[model samples]
Target chain A: MDSSSLLSRVRVVLCRPSHPGNIGAAARAMKTMGLSRLVLVAPRRFPDAEAAARASGAVDVLERAVVVETLAEALAGTVVSVAFTTRSRTYVQPFRTPEESAREVLQALQAAPDTQAALVFGNETNGLANEEVWQCAFPATIPANPEYSSLNLAAAVQVACYVLARTCEAFSPQAGAIADAPDFVPVSHEAVEGLIAQWLAVLERLDFYDPAAPKRLEARLRRLLARTRLERAELDILRGMLKAVARKIP
Target chain B: MDSSSLLSRVRVVLCRPSHPGNIGAAARAMKTMGLSRLVLVAPRRFPDAEAAARASGAVDVLERAVVVETLAEALAGTVVSVAFTTRSRTYVQPFRTPEESAREVLQALQAAPDTQAALVFGNETNGLANEEVWQCAFPATIPANPEYSSLNLAAAVQVACYVLARTCEAFSPQAGAIADAPDFVPVSHEAVEGLIAQWLAVLERLDFYDPAAPKRLEARLRRLLARTRLERAELDILRGMLKAVARKIP
Candidate 1:
């Protein structure tokens, strides 16, 4: 399952969110992580300017969001749902980290392509009640400060979406490879040997290399050259510098 | 070093942030992850009511935040800093994912307890300039959607802090263990055997078990019993149910 498809199977469900700005912020957060589905359950306000302003570029997510009257309706087709909560419950529910929950969700999506998963978040003030949490098969929590673990609703969504994106392999740092350096071709072994020979010749011309007392200099130079996974452009620069130095040696 | 102290040594630096609400949201994000120190580099507006309101319970982080005129000034004491950027730069800087960057930062903090590290975020509009990014030792980019990768300023901060908190083991889902279940004692071997015996006795009284045609039922029951790592309370419930059934069988 590719990352985006895996993420597509997952949805973010906000239950009884009071602040319209948080709804917008949550939309922006979800979109940034490549998650487009948003389900708002009984929100206090919708179609508000504050949410649109906060959503910034992700107002499309809000525009396409599904507003439901009940949490069950929001999670209608999900094969598995994770309740995002911090409150300690009386029931014996196993809680997993966001990373763990994401992995599980992705695994389920991969195992059964048609299955959907949901990440459910509660209101800003009071989190999901016990009855609401019971609807979810998995309960996940973010570890925060003991003194103050009050994570803003949108901030919590951002964290969960980030984890899901990372776990699904949707985005990676290597994805940001230098786009401008299109000509960064790796030099061959023979090319590296040629560059080393030229460097030694330059050093000999400059009186920097001595036949009488080489003193492991050639071997050390070879090790250094091998250590660097030189690109063709870099090899060219080094060879050019050596030629320039040799020409000026006289 | 402990997770809190390790997190305390790291600070968040927002360079040229334009929105006061973002500053407050960033502060809230940091506090939720057990981070306290915040440094702002030439924000467009500060000491604004919008920032305070957005900060929510994290106003203390904002109040104690250090405001500096220059990015260099903000990063004075940091041994290493990660420039968070999504821009395609002309320079050959390596971009790491947030998780990898967090591991690197935590490794540095653990190696030298007194040394400090910083996660630097760019402006809401243009992000960090190339010159500003060159000032940092490492550059990080969040793996976001290629089509719509504009993560909100505070949302980015939340993701970074959440990763850092997870890397430092500051908060974990296991920390939300059921606090009310104080008497969750593991059942003794003798108690489990006793319960099994009682259950079999009840089944025999009800004629569900036959001496001549056991049909591997006893072994199957034993296997089922071993599969469950029963608690004392669970064993008690089972034993009580078996006793009631046995009394009714007569």
Candidate 2:
């Protein structure tokens, strides 16, 4: 399935959220990761100015958000649900890391074209209730500092959405592809050999290399050049320095 | 070699952040993920109430944050730095996704134990200036929605720190390990066979199965049960349901 279609099928359900600004921030976070579906369950205040203000450019997401009275209604028709929690609950299966949860979420969506998934988050302070957590199919945790695992509501949403986007390839950029890096011309062995020769000649002129007692200095220079992987530009700089010193040698 | 030691070596550099709340929020984000080193370059305001209130429980991170006059000062001792940019700049190599950046950052840290690494963020309105980006060894992009790629400063920090934490295993929880999951007792072949037999018997009593022309129903049911890898508790539930159905039939 296409990333957008799959991502669109995944609902971000916020249960009993107290702050309107967080709701706005969550909307912005979701939209920024190409996730548009938002479900608010029992929000203390909706249509608040703070939410709209915090939402910034994601007003459309807030406008289209589905506000429900309960988590059950928010999660209705979702084939699977993963609850984000910091606490360890024994009833639920092993908690998934965010990356694992993203993979599983995408896998489930791909496994069934019509099936929908829900990423359920709880209140800022109380988090998800045990009963509410039980309603979800999976329990996921964002591994954090043992001393301070409390992530702000919107920040948590951003991390989850970011992981999901990356896992699903919602964005097309390759992780490590330097898309605009200059075209690299591989340095030939001949060029390296010439550069080494020039370097040796310069060192000889500077009395750093002695013809009478060579002492494996040339061999060591060759090894150092090979390890450095000199680029053409870098090689030019070295050559320029060598020529400048050779001029002064006379 | 340890996660905390490696994580501590990473510096979260905010270049000319516009808002103090974002500064505080970034501190909270970093601390939650076990990243404590925060360096601010020319922030509009520091030691502000909004920042403190937003920092919430992560005041220590703020208290210890290093404020510098320039990006160079913030990155002085760092062996390598990655500038976060949303724009496509022709000057830098391909933009790294947060995950890739995290792996590379950790790899660089591991390769040189004494070296430090920086994750640089630009101002809220305009991302990393071209000159600032050029100063860093690597450029990274968050792989956000093309339409709305603007992640608030703290959100970006959260994603980066979260990725780094996960990559370095700063937190002890394994990505997929269910530390608190109940010990799974594997179902034996005999147990599976017994459950299948009981299920067939119950089906026969319910008129759902016929022994005279067993039409592959038992075979299909057996195959289904084998694929399920039913847990002991699940097996017991099935048996109790089957027994209840048989009792009703009588």
Candidate 3:
């Protein structure tokens, strides 16, 4: 699916949110990843100062967020519903990384452009209840250290968006310039190694290596050479030098 | 390279942001991925109520965050620095996904674990200044849609840490577990260089260099050994064999 449809058609659902600040922070997170649609399920507080203030520059996202009374209401129109959970459930459900889920979401959207997908986040403390988890199609988990895997609400939103953004191939601090010039690539590693080998031959032939009482000089020299990051043209010029010196010697 | 040292040896720096809440959110994002070191460079407003409120339960992250006057100060002592950008500059640069950059960072750390690496983010609006991007070694760009790619500051941090965490081998949603397991680490570049020098002496004594018409054989040999990624113990064993062989030379 095209980027516009995938981004515009996806919805972020926060179920029974307890905090005004988390709602605001989550709004900011959603906007950063190019997500516009936000659905809140029975939030304790709506349009609160803390939520708006927490959104920072993304106040528009808070203003645009859709408020609903239940998780079912939020999931009503979405073609797919993905829930973020910490615990391993009794009944096994297939869990996919955000990247994989994003692909699936996009593919589903591609097949049905009018339909949408929902990324659901549970309440701060109770998390998504068994009934809430049962409503979602995919159970997703962020791979964090299990000992202290209690990820904050908005941070989870940020990671989910990040993975989605990466999977969908979205934004940059500045990306267009890099995208326009793909041919200007670095010298291949193989070429760099070859040039270094040539230089080594010349140095050794010039009697640079001292067999007896050899100090750390050669290693230091190698390090110095590595620093220059010799390009392809530079490598050719140095290779020419090697040929010249080789002919000059016996 | 182990996951423990890599996370500890990396710093996340946000430079000259206009919002205090973004800084707070960015801090919380870092902690979720097991990253703690945060350095702020000349933010417009800090020690702010909005930032603390946005940080949620991660107030400790804000409490421990380092505020600095310049990006250089934040970058001081870091062995490598990477900058995130959206647009490409006049001269082309090497851009890699956060996953790839993390591996390179880990490899560098394995060579010198005591040293640190820095990932720098630009201000909220201007993104990173061209001069700021120049200060970094790798110019990283997250692929987002060009039409409206303005990502939230903390979301970018989340994506970066998420990619890094995946490469270092998954969760301590708490850390310190991997920090204790430092055995079987990569040998330092200096150590590798020293080993090459010792072997060169051995090869010369063995008449492998052909004293009259020595070619680029030594350089080729060095390049080949460099590819092996000699571990510390491997270097020691090779050095011991070199010494033993050198003693047998007539």
Candidate with maximal DockQ:
3
TM-score, candidate 3, is 0.67
Q: Per-residue alpha-carbon lDDT of model 3 for A150-217, expressed as tens digits?
A: 67788788788878876766654334444423323346768766765665565455555444644654
Ranking by DockQ: 3, 1, 2
In model 1, the runs with Cα more than 4 Å from the true position are: A173-250, B173-250
iRMSD value for model 2: 30.3
Question: For residues A1-250, could you state the per-residue lDDT of candidate 1 as single tens digits?
Answer: 4677778878899999999999999999999899989999999999799999989899999999999998878877665678899845544435678888887666555655565788999999999976677666557788788888888999899899988887766777433211122333444445666787887775555455676787755654553343333545556655654554444344
User: Cα deviation of B184 in candidate 1 (Å)?
Assistant: 6.0
User: What does candidate 1's lDDT look like per residue over B48-117, in tens digits?
Assistant: 8999999999999999999999989988888889999994655586788888899999988888768899
The CAPRI class of candidate 2 is incorrect
* Candidate number with the higher TM-score (1 or 3): 1
Scored on chain A only, each candidate's TM-score is: 0.68, 0.68, 0.73
Clashes of each: 0, 3, 19
Candidate 3: lDDT of B224?
A: 34
Q: Which scores greater on TM-score, model 1 or model 2?
A: 2
Residues B175-216, model 3: lDDT tens digits: 322233344455544455577677666565555555466565
Cα lDDT, all candidates: 0.78, 0.79, 0.71
Model 1 chain B: lowest-lDDT 10 consecutive positions? B241-250
For residues B1-250, write the lDDT of model 2, one tens digit per residue: 8999999999999999999999999999999998899999998999899999999999999999999999999999898899998855675377887778888888888888798999999999988888899899889888888888889889999999998988777785653355443734557899988987887776666555678989866665564455445556556655664554455454
